[model samples]
Target: MNAIQIKNVTKRYKNVAALHDVSFSFESGKIYGFLGRNGAGKSTLINIIANRIFADSGEILIDDLPAKENIKVHEKIFCMSEADLYDAGLKVKDLFKWINRFYDSFDLDKAFEIAGKFNLDTNKKFKALSKGYQSIFKLTVALSLMVPYVIFDEPVLGLDANHRELFYDLLLKDFQHNERTIIIATHLIEEVANIIEEVVLIDQGKVLLQDHVSTLMEMGYSIYGPAKEVDAYCADKNIIGYDELGNLKIAYVLGEKTPLPKNSNLSASAMNLQKLFVKLTEKGGI
Candidate 1:
């Protein structure tokens, strides 16, 4: 297969399982949102794929080739990790030159162009750049790489509003141009909700769900009305949970079959991506 297949991969740290028999695939030419809460195995999974860390069991394959310790497979995947991999003293321009040499397909001119757009001073050393500018520089490098698969771990970290907007705009433009597999591991679900075609949700070292965002949204909804009316409406439905305020209530129901509430005053609306995520991953009973 051409997809990045992660087959029953597992990783653990002491007694804590970072990834528990997790299996998922990133198909070619699609944007995916890799979502999870803190310590939910997002970084662990990224590290295993990037060969920065090894899985205790199972394997990861790219186009049928094993990924662990395989240089050829790593060539096809580029992960801009959250950790700083660059030397702080290296000048931005020199770092670009080094990257061009390492990755033959890297577009130096394009990287420079993006740097200019972000007002990133290429002459300055990496340590001299602001936090936001550091992210911008890394994003510029990732965007310039002409690779088959690109995994961005917190790509928008430390970026301001304007820069974040520009980053997403450029990311879409780049994806449209190349149509490669782009996986964004981020906490800002609402920001990337519309951009991502698919969602892979992980919680406590396990995949809770993986599906099309639109389909997932369609599978769940919110019903609002009086407490008694809401309870009656959700009685037969699959209620994930609900909120109560005075005499009013809002119940979150899952599944496609939604009949009209018996009471006319009751109202219902489709669940958005953020709401669905929270409902699924909340620690306490929801």
Candidate 2:
């Protein structure tokens, strides 16, 4: 296992800066949630890491080695995304064979086992499988790799409820058994919140915050009670967001939770990841 560092990485699309000097490190043997809203440069950063696209400035290093079209670096990391990479003329089984040829540690038997579990037919051509099945096949391929890092971009893109749950279970099992670095970039914050150890929240084209999930969760708490009391309690504190209905109120406060006044009706509870994400991402709302 090795660490991947994105040092002052910057990318542009004509005038729009996709990634604006983004810098972060993904440690070994942990799962990281690369989160952001639509057009938030999450995909740009992922693509740069995979060497699918180049960053106009800065560097990406894997274990201190430059990852600029470096074969060794590429071998250590595998990205399974929505980009259709498989040959449409080849069957799923054939594609697996081709992938096995490229990756020496690719477990063919395990891939087939996962395929059977996902109810994906191996004999079907790439173009013949449904969207969900295609996602299942790619996810199976990702699970079968014996690399140090595995990245999933929209991993459960078209998966149903049961399959999504099963995939999460299997992914947790795989991570526990092999202990590799897994980075999942997805919009489903609530689903992967518990699975990831660290959080990287990006907005617009820059990183908003990056820290341990527990630490971020501790940074804020939700206070609820009567509307006036809640509003008064949050006035001096760092208020991230709030919700009000008639006389009821809930205010999410960042920084530190202040002591309530004597005989106050306000109560405080830990804020959830989804709520935090919503509060932080809202434009000019928080």
Question: Where does model 1 exceed 4 Å of error?
Answer: 221-270, 284-286
How far residue 150's Cα lies from its native spot in candidate 1, in Å, is 0.1
lDDT of 1: 0.89
Q: Write candidate 1's Cα lDDT for 1-286 as tens digits.
A: 6889998999999999999999989999899999999899999999999999999999999989999999989889899887889888999999999999999879999999999989999999999988888888888999999999999999999999899999999999998889999999998898998899999999999898899988887878888888988888788888887788999988888887567745367888866577678877987624
Model 2, residue 56: distance off in Å is 0.7
lDDT of 1 at 95: 97
Pairs with steric clashes in candidate 2: none
How many Å off is the CA of 160 in candidate 2?
Answer: 1.0
